[model samples]
Target: MAKETKNFVLRLDAQTMEAIEKWAEDEFRSVNGQILYILCEALKKSKRLPKTKNEPTKSNT
Candidate 1:
């Protein structure tokens, strides 16, 4: 099954939005895609992203 996504309004300063637009253009991604990528990376860095069913759990030695 495909995952469901929620949509909501996001307010951003003009400077921040401009930066994101430039970044997204360089990376060939839409603003929404760029935002999702950033959020996923941050979650992974914080070890807060949930493990998918296909991922194996780590074993402590």
Candidate 2:
């Protein structure tokens, strides 16, 4: 099954948008994908991203 996503409006200044656009292009990702990647990374860094059953937990060697 595919994950469901919600849509909403976000407001950003021109400079910020431009920067994101450039970063997205450099990484070969659409702006939306880039934004999602960034958000997921932030969540993971803060240990706030919920883990799905299928996701494997990191094991210390």
Estimate, for each residue in 1-61, the C-alpha lDDT of model 2 and write its tens digit: 9989999999999999999999999999999999999999999999899987777878722
- Local accuracy of candidate 1 as per-residue lDDT tens digits, 1-61: 9989999999999999999999999999999999999999999899899987776777632
List pairs with backbone clashes in candidate 1.
none
Q: Which stretches of candidate 1 lie over 4 Å from their true place?
A: none
Residue 58 in model 1: lDDT: 77
Candidate 1 lands at a TM-score of: 0.88
| Residue 2 miss distance in model 2 (angstroms) | 1.1
Give the least accurate 10-residue stretch of model 2, judged by summed lDDT. 52-61
The TM-score measured for candidate 2 stands at 0.85
The Cα local distance difference test for each model comes to 0.93, 0.93
